[model samples]
Target: MLRNWQEVLDLLAIIVKIPAALIMKVEPPHIKVCLSSHSHGNPYEEHEMAALGTGLYCETVMATRAPLLVPDALADPHWRNNPDVKLGMISHLGLPLVWPDQNIFGTICVLDGRENHYSPPFLQLIQQFRGIVERVLKQIYYDEVRVHEEAAIRADDAKRVRLEFAAIRDREQKALQAIKESKQRWHFALEGAGDGVWDWDMARNTVFYSKRCLELPGFPEHKSLVDFAEWERCPHPDDAATVLAEVQACLDGCIPAFANEHRVQAGGGWKWLLTRGMVVGRDDAGRPLRMTGTYSDPQAGRSRLAGTERPPGRTGRHADGGIAARHGTDRRHGKDGLAGPPGGRCGPRIEHAGGQYHPVIVEPEGSHRGYLRARRRQAADGQRAGRIPAQRQGRL
Candidate 1:
């Protein structure tokens, strides 16, 4: 931990009793002193640079990738002309510093003014210090690499979270938009039809009546009806049983639709209502979940045909594919449909047949004068045959 390069060099200078000790770093075509000793008469300074290819001790050690020793540079012919000898540094010894990849880093070396020989202990001490410097360089490299890798991982995670959040937000927006559009369409349909609408939640036995529905029965628009029992009370007593029975048949799956003509008590008098509805929702068990329907008044059109009539014995279909003569033909009978007595009310009645209710609008009757005269003659013949008394014959 106490591996400061200058401190190591200073301690080395004292232990070896040398005038100069340093760590030099190699830059292409030049070498610089990175750390220098603080010993007295030490001529070298830290960060000093000199050209390579010169006869400098550190440069030669780096070039050879081995240790260099000159006990007395002035006396050795090979080192006699070395630049350091002219500067009064005649003794030199150094070991080359190599990186992990075998590239030369520089040299750790010492110089002396007097002639000296570096012993084994002095050489080993400098080698151990070199190992410490290399370890520090390796640690620095590893820490820098790890910092970059962790930063990249954090950036990737942030990007993924942003994408997922955007996708979820898009889906939520689309769902809300769809619900808004559906509600708008529903309201538009209700406004245009002008029919009294009702929704019944069959599972809860609760009903929700629209403003039109409440108004149709001469009730205030602000009144809320939540119970089916209350709705049952609104219909005329004579028609309530028939209406409920038809509705029940639909709920029980015996009929495809609930359709019936009934009367309800209004503010003025009884109002005829043509009620049509069907089960709109179902559960997994095939039970009814919800039902919806509309209330319409057919009297507006029926009033237009008040005085219409048909010719005698002329039975044919109306434009609506049912008998046109309402006063005479009873479709419940076979062909050659029996005509009711003249002036009798003969509107189609709602009846359950073949698992559903159907309307059979009948043809109107002939002239009342002809039908009544024929009826009286038939009663006289019955009295003459003694099948009826004279008093009963008079009533007929």
Candidate 2:
């Protein structure tokens, strides 16, 4: 009986351009759709009826035994993927077509390619058709041709819900994949710059220092690295005070957040490092949450510059005494200070390299700003000594 009802509704809905609508029977143990615009195209064999399962959402309306109208499939949390929806049909209107005894015989439905909130024309059409379908169903009941349509409606509802769930799961999987690829791309770009990066988690008080950052500090082999405390212990005492002061000023928001070039004495030799940073972002309430920065070693520039625009390497003989060893390698990890590499090559001498360390040490044209020069070197006895090298008396 439901099969025959479905056959009529399906043909009518298609001919009228109303998307999949259902005529359901509101009875106990069923309350399903007897005929559906979808089921109309297919044979209503018992196996086929069972197979329809919950393939559509109209059965849901029937199961609830209420006249439901879903205007926009895309906007509706329910029926978002109804076949009519997948077919680009959007508006839906369903009126319960009941029998003479107030028993819901089925529903008169209409669908549109565009969304609607049930207009006057649609309401009038529903009233007319429901009156017709209901009267026909009552006559059939008297004829004993009435088929229970409640089961069909419930089955369609179940299917619609399943399809909606599948769509959600597929969307989430795609999002996760995109996120994974984005992170990989981010890391690749960060590593390619040869800049050492570090992040300070304020709440955790934990330091996240990249391997490149450690390398920039000349402590690439450090078994462990901590925050400011551990790092300050290795900074040249004289430079430590100024470096810490500048860092504090920036972090405290007292100064405009910015980058500064400073020399850090590592392994007894002072290496030029460019430190860049900013309070670019903040958490809610605008409190500082995390700080990120990068450091780059510019010693390579010194070697590279010497070969480029400079007078020929002129060895300077100090008028004082001992030979001012221009070739020097200082590797100081605080505790041991500066350790020489086998040969007792002292630190960089002023006379050989020829320039003051202030402003730009190598570039004579670089701004002669208020920059200071503090050099760290190892003496002949291998003891690390910190001093403002005697007025460019030494050579590079």
Candidate 3:
């Protein structure tokens, strides 16, 4: 746009046959030559400053918001001392430029070395050129305003999106942590119960077994159990069909619960297991979605049926599936058949050694008083059951 304005100034110089023509920019206390005509003998240069002196043509035009014309500076006493006269420009014509808001911008002016009157047509032409420059300035201002508005809107949207994504990520992390904690709690509870727990996803025909459940069937300790068929193979051949029938009855909603006594292969031959389960979850149409159960190895005293004397490393079972020594001697070598402290489920077991029945407390070392009290209580219970010797009765 400035290039086009410069071309207009050059054409003005050619049309008016002037030595100099300029487009000036009003900068408060001074006016600067923004563009100068390319005509020969033009004294003013582009970007040169002209002071706001009393008699300069551009300054007077801008002060009045009107045009200024002087046919000859020497002939007019008011303009005789003007700067243009000292520079050999004796004639001048200029029109004031204004913004759309009517603020003064500057002037478009022509200077000549000779005295000459500018025609009316030339004056009108300069006014039209001034209008074009004002319109260009207005368009540029509006374009910059639009660009700034769009940039502000984009920045606001980006900030909102970032906040939303951060919120979602925070929620996901919290949910994952909660799931991890829940799994740990469930595993702890199941292991503490000392029962072999199992879960069956009926819809997928998959089964899950806990560590205790795996040990009951004498399978190696593992974290996961996938194949239901493999679990079916653990039951003794004689009891498998009946157990399956009972479980199927419960799954079909024919029984209140799945309850069955079965034998499963164990570390010490087949051990009797009392298995119980129920449908814990159901689909919308009443089909069982999931089933959970427990395994109880009820053969604690079954070894007594083989003989009156129990072998070493073999745990003895009582009439009610509890552990007790009938041979006046009991010993345990591993994690099995041991309970710790009063808060734990497994109580102390009695061991007869060196002519006396000593109570074995499964707590940490250094519990002599508890052991003595347990022994006294065991002696009383055994004497009532007629299992203790009369000579040892005074030991209580």
Q: What local distance difference test score does each model get? A: 0.66, 0.50, 0.67
Candidates 2 and 3 compared by lDDT, better number:
3
Candidate 3 yields a Cα-based lDDT of 0.67
Q: Write the per-residue lDDT of candidate 1 for residues 1-396, one digit (tens) a residue.
A: 434777888899999998899888899788988888999999888788899888787777877888888999878999988888887999988888777667777888899999998899998988898888878766765687789888888888888889988998998889889887985576458635656778887567677777667766566765555776666665554344345545655666766776665566676566666676778887787767788887766444331122233223323222222222333432222224445343433233333355433323223343222344445677878743222212110000
What digit string (tens of lDDT, one per residue) describes model 2 on residues 1-396? 556556666666655555555554544444443555673332222222322234354565555767677778889777787765665667777766656776655455666677768667656765776776766777877655333465566678888889989999999998898987885575456656777776666555445667777776567565234754455454333233334434444554655554544455555465556665545545666555566777676445542211121113211111221021122211211223433222211122111112111111221111111111121324344655443223221111
Cα RMSD for candidates in order: 16.6, 23.1, 19.6
C-alpha lDDT (0 to 100) for residue 119 of candidate 1: 93
Give candidate 3's error at residue 291 in angstroms. 17
**Clash count per candidate:** 7, 31, 2
Better of 2 and 3 by TM-score: 3
Please, what are the lDDT tens digits per residue for candidate 3 over residues 1-396? 888998898899999888898888888677899899999998888889866765677878888887888999999998999988988999998888777567777888889999989999998998889889888877876787789999988899899999999999999999999987986687678667656778887556678988878876667766356766666666554344345544555666666576555566676576666677777888787766788888766554342221122235333322232122233323322223332233211123223355322333333232323334445667878743222222111111
Rank candidates, TM-score, best first.
3, 1, 2
lDDT score, candidate 3, position 142: 74
Best of the candidates, lDDT = 3
